[model samples]
Target: MAPPVSESPPVETLDLWLLEAAMELPTPLHMLVEPNPHIALNMADDPRLSREELCERLSLLAERGLIRVHALPDGLQELFSPEEISSAIDARQSRTPFGYSLTDAGGAIWEHHARPDWSRFVNAGQEPSADEAQDAWVIEAASLEAADAEFHFHESLGDVHQPVGESKHGEVLTPWQVTYWKTLPHGYRLRYVTVPRPADPARSRSVPSRPPWYTRVWL
Candidate 1:
């Protein structure tokens, strides 16, 4: 018997392009928000980056399913919100918040992308301009090496720990971080990476955002 024709649609060309864009920005914001968005995205120090630079990186994040451009307030009802998308501004005036970060879907992406070290940050500033969320990813990746030693000392560790997006509802798989954690008790870890293949295309980590720990090749 022959293999059945797969119904899965071909990967959206635009999505692939966007993923590439996300990789390019690799701004490094995840470190701030991962454990808690309000505390990180809102409270951290501050820095600056240009719109052109941000737009390019954000484009990739959008493609990676990390973030979306649809305009709507946050809430379950908003998921289905409807609006007219004009080519002129892409509805900029109405956009809920025109910026960058992992979309609600990013929860799952973090699930997959995160390792025990996903929570750390490097020399990143507390605050960043334009794509604040995008920049977090980089800080989050770099801090891994540094935080591993001092994190346990923090008060936050004493409480029942859980990832920012996770809830009592249990493990959730979201589009933002397409990857899920492999180990539960051991802290965030990668669930899978395009499974190993002989000379398969390497795993693509957003540049600068991924950091040095992800040294393995072939995604």
Candidate 2:
């Protein structure tokens, strides 16, 4: 008979897991309070944490200096004290949701505890390959369009004789051809075709011809 597979160990409590999620960026209170399918799949039990409980947890986290609460969406620059934040939540005065972000201490704890492994967690409901997870470069940008435009402007350049956006391997791509992308802690991990050199070797007569085959770069 085949040996039974052992179950994986739990990483941390649901509250701490939420802390790690906030470490990525400032998240709205509604997103945290809502039922996350990803978190539910990993945990043994999925409890619909009440607003009171959620606020209490946030207050506790804030008191410990692990997180900061803001009024949102304009109050990101202004942080609220634990007592004040809790009161605001309890009062339900604001029409907009509150935002939560990790403090320096919280970031430190996340770095110490979280692994850089992508296979362990799902990104956009799909697991990335080990190579992609390890080799991908993190890009910080306000939006995907901005990041894509910047990448093309910096990486794609050549003389009139040679076409732009053509990889060394002769694979031609447009400026906005971002094949794959995933969210990261600070920004995004994007995979796209890269042209290391001019597509036409003859344009640069002195340089030797490289091998023909396009390779994807994880940015």
Candidate 3:
């Protein structure tokens, strides 16, 4: 018989941060526990976790099958439980590499906990209809705030064409920031959108915006 599923631990601020980091890239245990230049630069203000504490939490996630610990390069050939992987690292066994990646369950949990309202936003790939495309949309780009513009769909243009809009602050939106977007209703006004920061998971900051716009859109 399969082993019973372990109870999921309380999702702490740091745990969500770790899960997000692993999601972006399969992370080795050391990268999380030790002070690395990348982590130092990106996660400067985040709390520092000891190896033991990190391992314990990771073990819980593994036992619950929320995350998978496996051999690196290609994790399919060999898999390791959190404890087993931790022991290998402690022993300084370099022959085999280990890293963490979220399982389906982990991804679900992370989405549920981290981006509770993400479903409202439409993905960038899902282009608006010809009629809808004619209207301006509020786009959540890489930078903090959303941009109001009309996305293109020309044959030469790829998934998203060059967007043209009235200049407010002369801010430019990069291709990557054009990830998610939503339409603004006719009489609404644009207000601050709250987004969670990975560095400081506990607190949420507003997506900076200018004074009241013509229509309000929830991001």
Candidate 3, 10-113: lDDT as tens digits: 66676666666665456665566555624533443444666677777777777767677766744574344556756745533576567677766676666565
Clashing pairs in 3: 141-177, 142-177, 188-215, 188-216, 189-215, 189-216
What RMSD value applies to candidate 2? 16.7
**Poorly placed runs, candidate 2 (over 4 Å):** 1-12, 35-47, 73-96, 117-219
Q: Residue 78 of candidate 1: its Cα lDDT? A: 16
lDDT (tens digit, per residue) of candidate 2 on 118-190:
3222121122435532222222243455445444443433422221333212121222212122233333333
Give per-residue lDDT, candidate 2, residue 166. 36
**Candidate 3 Cα misplacement greater than 4 A, ranges:** 1-9, 36-41, 77-83, 90-95, 116-219
Whole-model lDDT per candidate: 0.29, 0.45, 0.46
Please tell me which model should have the higher TM-score, number 2 or number 3: 3
The best candidate by TM-score is: 3
lDDT for each residue of candidate 1 in 1-219, tens digit (9 for 90 to 100): 112322233433333323322331322323212344323433222222233433444454455455654333322221111121112124344434332333434434333333223334222212233543322111112223443333322212322221222111112223223122121222221111111123312222221223443211112
Off by over 4 Å in 1: 1-7, 20-69, 72-83, 87-90, 95-124, 127-219
